[model samples]
Target chain A: MTGSSVLFDAPGPKARRNSLITSIVGGALIVAGVVWMAMTLAAPRESGGITLPGMFDESRWDIFADPELWGFIWNGVIGTLRAAAVAAVFALILGVVFSLLRSSRLKWVRYPTAVVIEFFRGMPVLLMMLFILLVFSTGSYWAVVSALAVYNGALIGEALRAGLAALPRGQREAGLSLGMRELQTKLLIEFPQAFRQMLPIIVAQLVVLLKDTSLGYIVGYPELLRATMNNLSSYYGNRYLFPLFVVTFLIYLTMNLLLSWLARSLARRRNSGGGGRGRRNAGGDADVSPDQAILVAEASAAARRSTST
Target chain B: MDVVIDNLPLYLQGFGVTLLLLAVGGVGALVIGVLIATMRIAPVASLRWFATVYTEIIRNTPLTLVFIFCAFVLPYLGADIPYLVSAFIALGVYTSPFVAEALRSGINGVPVGQAEAARSIGLGFGQSVSLVIFPQAFRMTIPPLINVFIALTKNTSVAGGFFVAELFATGRTLANANGSAVIPILLGVAFFYLLITVPLGLFAGRLEAKWAVAR
Candidate 1:
């Protein structure tokens, strides 16, 4: 039952045999694909194949050991991280503001905030980057950061709103019963609890915001991808593009995986009753389970009426 | 603003290219995604592993790398596919994992009791999934599927990096032609994208509402 799919019962003897046959067939298909790709790459250069293994050549590989190239690549990575950090901060601030506005009592405030979120969510981050860059006269740094900030700000806002909406109405009633003002009750009681639920979702959106920094390359922002491309052309000409692209891809994969691991570990610690040190002492919402945290995040994203690119 | 009107035809062409990629890529992703989702749930351990690996790798890698691979790696390997074909392939392959994950979640949401009941009626594994599970799953899938499609539509802009004359590229050219009017040109491009995404987004919301009550 532990390994079983939710939709299937355990397999019987005959089903085991069928599974073996399918696995063999699947393995063959994968091998065939790899063989085809290798043959294509190993073909003659005049006939459009690289014909040379310049990518694996010691000379080309040595370029990576060069201090100048390494320095440039490091700078690009820092640029990407810096932009993402700034954008995440801005997005969180904006998300909190809009989500608060969304639940506002006034129609003018609520409706207009909804419209802005919808618009930002629908527009591509790349388009937003271009628009912001041109319209605001901000350089590439702000352009990239602002675009990511606005787009993700909308997503985080929706997630936070959903978190608030999912809370038991009695919590609000209890706060009011204590003679607290509505705004005070919300500010002191509601938002803190909602935020505890929203943390995982915010982290997920932050991963997305990080990946989007690669788009900064299109505008010559000297991010990781752009820096790698520059190094590729400068050092080995266009011939070594594939290897460099693979390297860049792996770096991104590693970063995203680290973020995911952080999410998982945080969830684990909370679920194990480790009394995770940062567990908020406020509002007695201290028992926010990790599973419930993720579920609310996903549900909120699903419940979001607005769509994003 | 006048620049937008003057270059309306150019913008329209770019818009057409974006739609073309979206239509073709959407179909390709749906087919592959369903196949991968089937593989994921299949009783074969190796096949399930394969599907898991594929999804993990593709979803983690950025779409830009996929585009670069299609644009350059294929040529390096002695294939000379057209720019549009390569771009479409990249878009389809990059997006399929997301589509598959959505469909898989949809599949999960259907009760095990439903599948067991289907099997009791003498349906095979494939038949149960296709006839009973998928129909129910797709309804649950529509909203998330729409989100994936919207992401795909926006991602098509990356084709501009590889020299496909899509909306963003059109905007770039317009900006270059009238440097001071960059604002209008970008506004026009963003408007064109909204023309496609905004309506589809609204429709998805309506559909989600329609389906929520049924669920």
Candidate 2:
């Protein structure tokens, strides 16, 4: 157990240097690629917004630099951000409600909730949004919101339930000993704790929901992806790559990269503190017990030797 | 009752297309996913980095965006691949990273000993991987990959933009022709999706249970 040989240890100086060099080279390649794209298609490509390539002129970057195209791109960004905000709020409410149902005393509540969770979880959001759109035309906006709520909420609901299950039973007993009613015990004691515990997963999934906003395009929401497509298609003769490269740089890639970055930071925050001593580790891996068993075996062996006097 | 009676065939047609797209997209995603996942975890640093960039870009971008990019943008790039082919290519590529992640986790679930054992028995890396590793990883990947399948199935709805003859698009076209009957038509489509997804979901659950440990 105390062997000096390092197995899966931290990267040493040489490895660290290699990692740094690799990162630099990768970053350089991305910049070079972007620059090459810009140089080839950026300047002369003009007028009716960015476009995809067509038969006559295959380069599509020219149209993107047009000012009018910026308007559509801007509008799309607003729509996406606005939709994501509304969905996040609704998803939180539904997530909390379902999480409560999943942990209820009665099988009726838990089983029904479980069924809904699986059904919604089982379905795809694209299908759900499409279904809600076609089925309830007036509620098209709500349909998207509902899909976001149901899907993200279900996953979050599971995260909350997992967090609650991971809680020490003593905490629940402690709440009961304090004379709180069952609902009150859950709401006042367990809910807050579980919510905090599951915060990382919750954050990451919400970012996913945010990115899922691009799914709005198919329903003609004219979101970022749709707008970009329109702008690119309009310019589909000469400036093929520029429009895509620029719009992708500004619109889809930048915003999502930020959200993903935020998710990572949030997870890091929770991970540093950890879920708690010995519950599930933050990455959702469920198999630390075997390692603990090994530790237990070593401890017992040492104890037995010490007692042999 | 009247709606169900009348719409049964409609639902069935949509269900068939749903299953077709689901099957094609799911299998394609699984294959691409393994390739991407292998690249993602490759021994070479550059390949791993490239795969990382690919997965991050794909994962963060919306599935609908990928659909649109494939259908509309690809053609404009002088890559006149037809809509159906592009839809398949895009959906397949979009779902692959997820499958890769799922399978990667599944692979990790197999203890390091299995690989060590295979190596000891004179298996090279490829033989050990395909013969020893993939079978076990495929089992563990069932549940999460089911989630990916659901995603791809739903994506068939997006193929509407590309004019692919899938469920949602079919419903959209039919409903538009019928004017404001959009709601009912969509409801029919929902029922269709439910029939397909619910059963597959159940099947995945059973598979997961069979492979799952006591924990």
DockQ of predictions, in order shown = 0.38, 0.20
Query: Which candidate leads in DockQ?
Result: 1
Off by over 4 Å in 1: A1-9, A35-51, A54-60, A266-309, B111-135, B213-215
CA lDDT of A76 in candidate 1?
81
lDDT of 2 at A120: 74
Best model per TM-score: 1
Error of 1 at B2 (Å): 2.3
Angstrom error at residue B97, model 2:
0.7
Report how closely model 2 matches the true complex, as a DockQ value.
0.20
* Least well predicted 10-residue stretch by lDDT in candidate 2 chain A: A300-309
Candidate 1 CAPRI level? acceptable
Residue-level lDDT tens digits of model 1 in A18-133: 88998898888988997886675544445345346534556446566768877877888899899999999999999999899998889999999998988887788888887777
Worst 10 residues of 1 chain A by lDDT: A300-309
Clashes of each: 0, 19
Candidate-wise lDDT, in order = 0.76, 0.65
